[model samples]
Target: MTANLHLIPLLPLLGAAFSLLFGKRLGKNVVTLVTCGAVAAAALVTLQMTFILHHDLPPGGALVDTFFEAPWMKAGDLNLSAGLWFDALTAVMCCVVTVIGFLIHVYASAYMEHDENYTRFFAYLNLFMGAMLILVLGDSMPVTFVGWEGVGLCSYLLIGFWFDKDANATAGRKAFVVNRIGDFGFLLAMFLIFYHTGTLKYSELASHIDGLHNILWLGLPVACFAGLLVLVGATGKSAQIPLYVWLPDAMAGPTPVSALIHAATMVTAGVYVTSRLHVVYEAYPQALAWIAGIGALTALFAATIGFAQRDLKKVLAYSTISQLGFMFVAVGSYVNGSSNYASGVFHLMTHAFFKAGLFLGAGSVMHAMENEGDIMKMGGLRKHLPHTHATFLIYCLAIAGIFPLAGFWSKDAILGGAFAAQWDVKNAGPVAAWFAMHAGKIIYGVMLTAAGCTAFYMFRLYYLVFHGKFRGTHEQEHHLHESPARMTVVLWCLAIGTILSGFLGVPESILPESLHHFGDLLGEWLKPVVGVQLHEESAGQFLGFAFVATAVSVAGIGSAYIFFLKDDGVRAKNFVATFPRLYRVVFNKYYVDEFYNAVVVRPLRGLSRILWKFFDEIIIDKLFVGGTAAIVNGFGKSVKYLQNGDAQRYVVGVLVGMALILRVSTHYSAAHAAQFHVDQDGHAVTAVPQNDAYTTNVRFKVEWGDGQESDADSAHPRGLKHQYASSGTYKIRLETTDSRWQTTASRSETVVVR
Candidate 1:
């Protein structure tokens, strides 16, 4: 069964290829069947793997099956191969991705029925699922990156599915580019891991973390830098503070895409990575602190912005960011010398259920209202779309962290983890421990406040969309109808998940004494992989945190009811009027996007324009390209005078050359006569002087074009002979010099050396 793990991701990849190749000819129904059926089959395989891991594998054991391996790349001592890994972690992720992915696919079939490019949409969706599965199940970071980049490409395609619209296309590009920033961080981390550990395999890397810490680059530990870089990548993928701007804009994509990618799978990749490499992160406490701090801040920041969003999906988008921040907090918080890795993954699982449900419900609402997305323009929708309203209400409660729902259990666990996180003042010196304790308290407070804001905003959206009188035009009201049964059925199934998935990770304090060990089931299941014992808090402490969480959620919901349900928007108007400046800031998303444009984007664009104008246009084009052309033209004009094609001119040039050679030869023979004496036979004779006080040795050498050189010698003062190794044009030179070597002259002529 473990050997069949490859099928989990391969099935969807094959489906995507088949749909892309034959979708148009196969027609919509066939394409839908292939797409949905493929994901469903993958989901079934994942379920079987999950059962095998739970029943067959021993406690604290993993089944690693190398399905197949091909050498991917080798650098020095490091080798990477493409393969699959199956364990508790992979099993959980596989189930979530394929199961929810199948639901989204089924929902999209009905939602996108009228679109002409329906097959194309399904193809992209299938590709996204396949890539997401690869990302989850990859045995090495490099293999994970293949899926990472694949999902990024599929995200770009799906986000801008309607490329005809400029806004949609721009949104897609923004998501792609912003994610690239994080991908670069991921790449750097992988390089550093390989550099320090000499391996990229997850198992090997984990084993080598201790060895990595002993190695240092510059003044800091290598593991610290690698952990930080991985966090940067995670931030971009998970939609943390700085890189989160792309997600709200990603709402321009089709609703099913929003549900699948933004709400469920892709955004959680960072949490998965953080949990996957817990050993490395545990060694660097400061890096984990940064992760926790950034996550806490983003949760509060996005929750505040969610308070002011009018668009339905935009609110959910910010909510997704906020929820992701909570998950990060869970993963990063090191309470009592251990991080709550399972709590983070548990929240990731539960957030998928409720957040995806909310998005799909919003899609149903939009479908009913003729594609109107503004919740402000929608009201009293419960009468027209009862199924969507019911599912939406449950999801809204789940997100608000109402008791016993998925969000309540997961979110409270995160908050509990934050509360449990404390500094060991006894071990640490006073000053550092003081700061740690105070920072933990501050983080706890901020997360609590963010949780309140989350509940408030979600209920505000709910009341505005489903409770009040119809606010749209009469024509929209007349056209309002429930979504198809297929869409509603997905909503109901997800709502059920929202209601029940909480039990999988029930807090021990809430359970009876006999069942206490059974609580935190997910934590126990994941203990083999994460290698951390779940810390048990006092029952009183658990009840206390649960009470605070429940109170805040109720307060948030009650406040929304008072503002929107009781009064017809008067309280909300009054509140906004009272705090216009603050409201404006929240409404504008703290102008973070604007600030990024003015500070980052505009400057980059300006620099690019300057480079294009001066460097590209003037320097490259005019100086190099245009200069070369001008030089060529000038040489061509100058050489035109020599192309007269006259035989008389050619004879005159030959006669002038012969005259010059005869003059030079006569001069050379006369100058060297003092050193040469002629015998009676009139042969040239050279004399050597024994008393050489007044003589100087002058040497001359000639190079023939055909790879032969005359040796330097004083034997031939006037000229040196050389042999041509082959037939070619040769340059010949002659030299004349006095005994003192003070006066010398040489000349060269080009001639055929055939």
Candidate 2:
């Protein structure tokens, strides 16, 4: 348990570096071997540590490795670290990342066998896993943020692995930019958390955040503001709303990238972070309610979009977005007035299983059909690819929440938790939570309907892709066959996992008294870190809600069977033609991308063009960059003319320069006379010196009417120099000359022949 934690992230990172540098030299096979082996090793260590934690430590115990003997980062009260913590929570995430990541890598070997950039693809995959592990195990927010940004970078790289394709590159940039909005919110939450609590460590924040619930920022609690910022990050990363336009477009990448980044690990980062910092949302029910509402709505919204997509991966893409919404709902629910974020993690794990399986199964279909991603071009695939068909069937049922499959248990837990959650939001200062007070039932209903939608669209995809008569070209039908053993084996493994992983979060409500302890195993494991408490509802009430969840899923499944499988999908097609406008709306994903482009992207781009033209080209380039060079060049040209060996020209240039200087430069003359003090006979003019001028450049002496000179540097004043010119007027003056012109002139402006 005290093992070096750095190895967990470092191994995959090193694998990435090694493969990238030498992968081409060593060949793709060797590169694949090293990258896969690195993850497998990390997975083994994570499992070993998980076993030790389970067997040796008390419930909620964690093994923390600071890596260094002392704290790595500290400044006044703001102490941070590059440490890793392995608790039950981290254990679940680590296993999901490494194990699933490894399988995806293995599957990719066969899936990408003929690709030329095999090594680059593996390198990005390795980098992604390493970053994800760091994110899961980091001991502090800063440490987690480092990993957070790392995965974002890796996603951009992996998603656009085929950079030659414009669409793939655009998809990568889209994900990068959208996540940045989320990351900014996350960064702000970190700053706000530190400002209020003086610490960003999860261990320290548990006690510190409770004190902030009463503190107000604006009109609402400071905790609410921080929680909202964190939720903003979650929505961006988890593909919730507004910012979710990027996830559906991410299908432009290779299938493994989709399965790895979108399905299993990278997209789940938001749920992981929220669950990790669940304490911040604890005291502010309004904040929690916001996340819950958004989650429920996004799930439903994405699921509806799924119903109209023709692309195999696009349907699954929307399904992934929809499922992410469920995880958010689970975390935000915080059921029964207690933190139940671990239930969200439970869904995250189960989702990694079925969703990854589904994506890979889709990949197998594409593999058999010559990389055709459109389900319209695919049907009767089940006949040619039986193993893939069987395994895909299991994943489909599991995702649809049918019966006791993996999706059913995890999704059922979330619905039950959300159903029981109490927002107490009536007292909230924010208007957003007005509907949250006693609104958990409505949220639950929305999630239930979304779950049903999930089943319908997934099966619609399944039926259209697997059940109908061969709709592809005759050449594709002739060559259609099951994928290689390497791929089919991974598919079966994931499918089996989708079946078994659900049992980890089995609700006690459905279990016998003797089996109650095992039913909530995942929840109990997270008790030490999250301390989530489930409300004990009567068995009948819990079972009744469970029945409702199951019935809705079954209804969706049955409906899909009639619309697609029973009548060869004629009804679905007829509905599409009859309701073309409505179908087009959903089919076009409600024009969200177009809306964003018109509203946000187009305006921003137009502004950018203006800035480039005026600010950059005119002000910066023409005025600054070009202006400075022009000045220097003009000076050089003039100097070169002067430096030409012509004496007459030089003499003329100096005279012209003097005349030009005289014309352009203005000169001002100043005259000052000391205050006159009259003598008794009025014959002598005595002068008192004015106070010394307040500048270092001024030093002076006064002259007396006796025609005597005085020391200019002396501190005392002499009498003013004066003589009666006409009646009583007197003036004094000093002589001066312009030596450069060799001319003399009167220096005094007051010398009027006095």
Candidate 3:
């Protein structure tokens, strides 16, 4: 059964390939069937695998299957192979990705029916699902990177699905470029890990983390630098503070894309990576502190931005970032003496349900309104699109952390984990204790505030869009109708999920004594992979935190009702007018985009222009290009002097060259006359002695530049007929000796071989 794990992702990949290659030919209905069927089958396979793993596998055990194995790469003692790892963590992720992914695909079919590029949209969605599955299931980091880059490519394609819009294409490019920055960190961390440990396999790296931690690279602990790099990569994919700007603009893609990629699966990849590598983080207290602090800050910061957004999808976009921050808070809460991996994953799961529901519900509303995304232009939609209104309300209540729903259980677990860290635990180290004492309180406070802001903005959106009088043009009002049954069906399914998924992570402290055993089911299921920890909070303490969270949510909801429902926008406008500067800043997303343009983008462009002008155009071109041309032209002119096109002058020059060579040879022979024995005719003597030896022999050998040599006797002492190889210099040597072998003379001269 584990061997079949490869099929889960392969199915969606095949669907994407088919849709991309033949979608137009197959028509829209067949395209939808292929895409949705692939995801649904994947979901079913995941469910079966989850059940089998639960029933058969022992606690704290995993099953690794190498469906296809080849030597991907090897360096010294390190080897990485492409494979799949199926465990409790992967099982949970598979369920979330495939189930929610299938639901989004189903919803997209109805939402995108009229679009000409509907098939292309489904193809991109399937590709994203397949890539995300590979990311979760890959047994090694390098293999996972293949999927990481795959999803990034799919994101660019999907985000700019309507390439006719410049803004959409620009948004896609922004997402790709920002993610590349994070991926650089990811690639570096992988290299450092491989350098130290000589392997990138997840299991090997996990087992060797302790041994490798002390190995420093660039004067920092390997764990610290590598862990921080991983966090940097997470910040980009998970939409944490500095790298989060791309997500809100990603709403330029279709609404289902917003639901699937941004809200549910892709954005949660950073949390998954962090959770998957819990061992590395657990060892570095400082790294854990950074994760906690950053998570808390990003959570509060994004939620505050959400307060002023008028665009419906943009509001949900910021809301996803804020909720992801809460998950990171759970991830970073290890300083409390518990890793809280299960809590982070629990929130990831529940947030997927409610957030996906919310985004899809927004899509339903948009479908009805002819694509009006501004909530300020929408009102009193409850009477018109009752199903969408109700489902959207349920999503609001769930995400607002109201009791019994998914958000309340998972979010409170994280808050409780943060609170528990404040309690001093023996042997947990002073750093952990100090962080729990000092930073924990601040994190808790900020996260609590963010929670209230979350409820406020969500309800504010709800009231302004569904409760007040119609605020848009009459034509839009007339067009307001419930989405098709196909879309609403998925919304209702996700709504039920929002209501029920919370039970999987219910805290034992919050349950009655009779039901305490059933609580924390998610923790138990995940304990085999992530390890289990007892949070150990009393009933009173749990109740106290739960009450505070619920009160803040109710307060936010009440404030929204008062401002938008009862006061008819008078107080809201006055509040904005009173703090115009602050309102404008928040409304404009703190001008972070402008800040980046000024500090990073514009400077890079200016530097590139300078380099192009001075280095490329002036220095490189003038020195290399123009100088080479000038030198070649001068050489051509020098050679042209020889090409006078006069046959008599060319022959005269050759004869003069031969006379010069003979004159030099005669001068050399006269300089050493004792070595030359003359014949009776006063000519140079040449003889071949007995026993194959030469004595008093005056033989001349003429060598040509063609590497051919010929000997000339005393009768024919001129140069031999030989063809030159091409064009170059040649050397001519002469040797003479007396019969008594008393002296030997050798002379050499240079001549043109052309």
Q: lDDT values of the candidates?
A: 0.79, 0.77, 0.77
Cα lDDT tens digits for candidate 1, 1-754: 3467788889999999999999999899999999999999999988987887889878755555564454556666656676777788777778888888999999999999999989889999999999999899888898789888988889888887866656465456556656887999999999988888877777767678876688777956788899999998999899985677678888888999999999899999999998888878766666788888889988887787777688999999989999999999888778666687888888999999999899999999998888898887988998999999999999999989998799998888888888767643335677878767767778888899889889988999999999888899999999999888999999999999999888888877768999988888988888888766445677888888889999998988887898777878766655546444442344245345344334422343344345435643565446544565678799888667655688787788899999999777555432442332211112211122122332345444444445555534454344334444556655554343443434555545555544
What global local distance difference test value does model 1 have? Answer: 0.79
Estimated TM-score for each candidate: 0.76, 0.76, 0.75
**Candidate 1: residue pairs that collide:** none
- Residue pairs with backbone overlap in model 3: none
Candidate 2 — what's its lDDT? 0.77
Tell how far residue 437 is off in model 3, in angstroms.
3.1
TM-score of 2: 0.76
Predicted model with the maximum lDDT: 1
Model 3 TM-score (2 dp): 0.75
* Residue-by-residue lDDT tens digits, candidate 2, 512-620: 8888878777877787777774445567877787789889888888878887778777766655564445423442443453443344223433443454366435754
Q: Extract clashing residue pairs from model 2.
A: 60-528
Query: Over the stretch 632-722, how does candidate 3's per-residue lDDT look in tens digits?
Result: 8998997787667888879988999999997665544423532222121122122211212222244544333345555554532433344
